[model samples]
Target: MHNAKPLPTYLVQRFQGWKATSYAENSAWYRRLASEGQHPRAMIISCCDSRVHVTSIFGADTGEFFIHRNIANLVPPYKPDGQQHGTSAAVEYAVTALKVAHVIVMGHSSCGGVKGCLDMCSGNAPQLEEKSSFVGRWMDILRPGYDRVVERKPDDMARALEKESVLVSLENLMTFPFVRAAVESQDLSIHGLWHDIGSGSLECYDPKANGYVVV
Candidate 1:
């Protein structure tokens, strides 16, 4: 009974079975896309977590969204170094090359990254300094947000941290020159979205009200 094929093998076989026909339904569009290149309408900044898939959640096709997934859905400050800037590069491509009209920083409830940042900000919490993980360094993007809310309350920790991280990423998004230029020209817009997985509720930041409201 245990001699059965591995799960990945089964999944791959199932995927291969569907590829030609399932994808062929959109083969014509794929051909056009190959010819003209991608010109996505929106760029989505999201977490690398498996549960936070932007494309599937938004029901978008291949060219609908220019995607960037990072440890905490962080948007780092733009730098011209030769080092690998994964999220920054994706943002650059979306803003400069794809000319995407909108960017969404999608944060979810109970995010490990945000939680880590919250813990790091709380002096009484365990120190992450001992860990050599990249997540520790990447989560530094939300330090300012952590500082802004860490003194408030304990029960509000996770949600406050999540919302603060979203705002931090939105600010970081504007740090890129191309994004700033596009936004200034009114060709681009930025949004902060927080999804509560537990309640299946969606909260979007309202610029006018300066807070998140259920959508």
Candidate 2:
């Protein structure tokens, strides 16, 4: 088997190098950014897949976006169970604290997590184990979409599953009290984007059209 160990090491080296280069080339900007605090224009909820980086894909520089990533980009309904609530906490910070004007829930093509839902692959399903793997369990938040998509469209299974997952996450975003308040008060707007990694393009969801249009 091709070991994956070398990849993280390579990435660490590259990240260190990038930080050094940034310091050398843009020390003033970096310093200013560090001092000024992040005033990101948008709060992005995206998949944790290393292949799909919100900043890199959006061509955003440091502090341009407040980002929260999780497996399959899933967002659970607002829950107060005395949990760490990382995603919820980030959303709270972005909306209430940072006051980001826009919030985007972005999904991507060929997502292994999405594919797992479509295929009903238990191997990829999340569970709370002795070792503490929680990604799969978190992905369960999007399971309703998987079931709904399968029931609604038995054909063209893949696309339906992916699209429905985005819709589901969008719906869940409203479950947060702060998000709903901002949305209702017009302080924030929410957008959904389906990214085509293959074509290096994005299709934005249009609530008016009830579909995605290339953007």
Candidate 3:
């Protein structure tokens, strides 16, 4: 492996600024959190897209949410093969150890991962079809979601697939016994959200309405 490089100057400066301002102002709260450990009320599964800022959207404090991000924010179905599963591990820890009260799967518009999935499913991304492609394999979890949205008109395909990613993740979360247990015991609630980047709008999936409603 190559030697690791130090952080860029801009990022270092930004960190120093935050340390002087936000950290200084909340030192006591930070110390208390360190001593007691984080007890976030929610676990958020969101896209790795830089545009979707979960904390900013909720105006949440540092220790208020446990966030896990992955390509397209997809969660694979419960699998216990003793292999490494990063997303699954995060979900397990959040549900069984932290006992987060809510788990939110949030998707967004113009997601590259979703586009890749769309291309792969449509046989347009031959590279992703290779067995050794990590992104491709990870996106296999979203194939069922693609299938659900594939019949839509071409103009609406991408957005429908993006929303389907959120719904699929929510469904897979329930396949985990701990998540289901928490929900059954009235300790956990699951949510699906989609954000429109261009419009700066947020929508929540309402099962009763059978569609997303602006929030």
Top candidate, metric lDDT: 3
With a 3 Å backbone cut-off (N, CA, C), the pairs that clash in candidate 1 are: none
lDDT, each prediction: 0.84, 0.81, 0.94
lDDT value, candidate 1, whole model:
0.84
Q: Rank the candidates by lDDT, best first.
A: 3, 1, 2
Candidate 3 structure quality by residue, lDDT tens digits, 170-200: 9999999989989999999999999999999
Strongest candidate by TM-score: 3
Between prediction 1 and prediction 3, which has the larger lDDT?
Answer: 3
lDDT of 1 by residue, 107-213 (tens): 99889888787777665445564467476677777888887886676478888888888899999888888889999999999999998777778899998998999
What's the TM-score of every candidate structure?
Answer: 0.88, 0.85, 0.97
Minimum summed lDDT over a 10-residue window in model 2 is located at 121-130
Structural RMSD, model 2: 4.5
On the 0 to 100 scale, the lDDT of residue 186 in model 2 is 97
The segments of candidate 3 whose C-alpha lies over 4 angstroms from its true place after superposition are 152-154
Model 2 Cα displacement at 193 (Å)?
Answer: 0.5
The parts of candidate 1 lying over 4 Å away from their true place are 1-7, 123-127
